[model samples]
Target: MKKRKILIIGLMVVGALALLTGCIPGDGSHTVAKPAGFFSGIWHGWIAPISLVGGLFNKHLRVYEVNNTGWFYDLGFYAAVISGFGGISLFRNKKSKND
Candidate 1:
């Protein structure tokens, strides 16, 4: 019973993620300009995983913008992705030997 409950919760979480990630619009017509700027890069990076999944089935999907502000946009995107994935544990409290 415990396993069943866990499985259900996991499935729900996965479904929710899919829904959230799948909402980003793709570029099929190639007319829509790529979003630029720092925040936009962060947003794009935050949703990159979802975009990757979307790209798997859709040729028009893109994980990153091609017309961004060069290095700044890339930096923001990478930073957002790293933070989002917990790559750099920012909230963990350090424990000293005294404690």
Candidate 2:
């Protein structure tokens, strides 16, 4: 029980740090460019298509911009949801008639 607590605390700290380092502007002096190979995964790859779909149409030149923003914000939210589940029975969590 104590170990689980500590492990969860550590995961929370790590996740917070990852968010800070990845999203937050560091120092703000440099250009704060995207990290190399940051978008080198299956999830990263979906970002482009998802964002494109998320930003279907607009008169102004804002498709790519909307896509990029949607990619990060939406993907981050989904990642959080997946992590929260801990790969367990989300739908069957409660004591139901089937159980």
Off by over 4 Å in 2: 24-99
For every model shown, what is its TM-score relative to the native structure?
0.58, 0.25
Report how far residue 97 has shifted in candidate 1, in Å. Answer: 15
Please provide, for model 2 over 1-99, each residue's C-alpha lDDT reduced to its tens digit, 9 standing for 90 to 100: 999999999999988655533322122222325321223222333333433443355233221222333455455545544654443566556787977
| lDDT, candidate 1, 1-99, per-residue tens | 999999999999999886666435355322236447687678778898888988899887888877667788789889889888886577878799998
Looking at model 2, residue 66 earns an lDDT score of: 25
lDDT of 2 at 83: 50
Instruction: Tell me the spans in candidate 1 whose CA falls farther than 4 Å from its real position.
Output: 1-35, 88-90, 93-99
